[model samples]
Target: MYGLMSILVHSIMYTKFITPLGIDASLNRFFEARAIDHVQVLAHEIDGRQERRQGLKEAAEYIKAQLERLKERAGSNFRIEIEENAVGGSFNMMFLGHGISFGYRNHTNILVRIVNSYF
Candidate 1:
């Protein structure tokens, strides 16, 4: 995903026909520098194990913080909503011999709304 984003940024920077609104050269540089930081934070903070529930919560918070930073930087009324739902009875091979047949976990759904008409 990070690679894809990097490719996309490069394409945008080089393409003559495509003009991203509110994204200048400086903002593009900012995103280029911070993109790896965002990925690193998510990878370290979000442990996708069923046993560690706090990791999911922390992941949601981290996403929120990143979105908030984006809103602040763009000076736009971008909105983010997170909806968490419980997923029950998920089967895992790791639990095969532990006598635990099923696992329950929470999944977070993130929605970002960019109010700009160009989007």
Candidate 2:
């Protein structure tokens, strides 16, 4: 039984885990639906027991660095937010427009998270 969840950063919107499938169509949809130009998976948790978990701090730092990279790429005029959804096992990267454009229409965002389980 594999569970997966989704998150939207600034608004803190989380989606229910669409379970029982190893193939995540939503993730594919998410990547394809947007003009993601640049995306880098910073933090990743391997499929293992919590007690055996390692690299958590490294993963976190990598994610933070990636967010900063994205911010730089988007320029100083763009506002970015990274929200971790540990409960949902996901993370949301949001971009708020501060110059040249405004609101949802102009700003772009991405949600990155993990899916893991064993039955």
Candidate 3:
């Protein structure tokens, strides 16, 4: 009775102080219009003394909170989720997939991956 759609969001943090921010809502809109049903977030890295910057735990929590906020804002407009199980102090990523079968489902599939260093 429905179709299948997929959206992939890949994020890589190669240095210290990598900021893991949520994807923009406008980007979600684009994906929703395409009837995407799955979102894959690839967050790589954790507590590692790669650089003399903020604590790894602190940064991890910050990233988690940011993602939670996005889910709350999305409400029913989109079905977003985060995958936090990375290895080593390397990559950080986030992905959001939306499904809009009744409304717009013929637009572009947007993949918004926001990354920041020394934040």
What TM-score would every model get versus the actual structure?
A: 0.47, 0.27, 0.30
Q: What overall lDDT, based on C-alpha atoms, would model 3 receive against the true structure?
A: 0.42
Q: Write candidate 2's Cα lDDT for 10-96 as tens digits.
A: 235555654443333443233432223222233223222232244443455555666566655553444556654432223345457
Q: Residue 84 deviation, candidate 1, in Å? A: 6.6
Instruction: Please provide, for model 3 over 6-67, each residue's C-alpha lDDT reduced to its tens digit, 9 standing for 90 to 100.
Output: 22212223335634433544643444422232221112333442344344544555557656
Off by over 4 Å in 3: 1-54, 89-119
- Give all candidates' CA lDDT scores: 0.64, 0.41, 0.42
Among these predictions, the greatest TM-score belongs to: 1
The per-prediction tally of clashing pairs is: 0, 0, 2
Model 2: how large is the Cα RMSD against the reference?
A: 21.3
Arranged by TM-score, best first:
1, 3, 2
Worst 10 residues of 3 by lDDT: 1-10
CA deviation > 4 Å runs, candidate 2: 1-52, 81-119
Angstrom error of the Cα, residue 54, model 3: value is 6.8
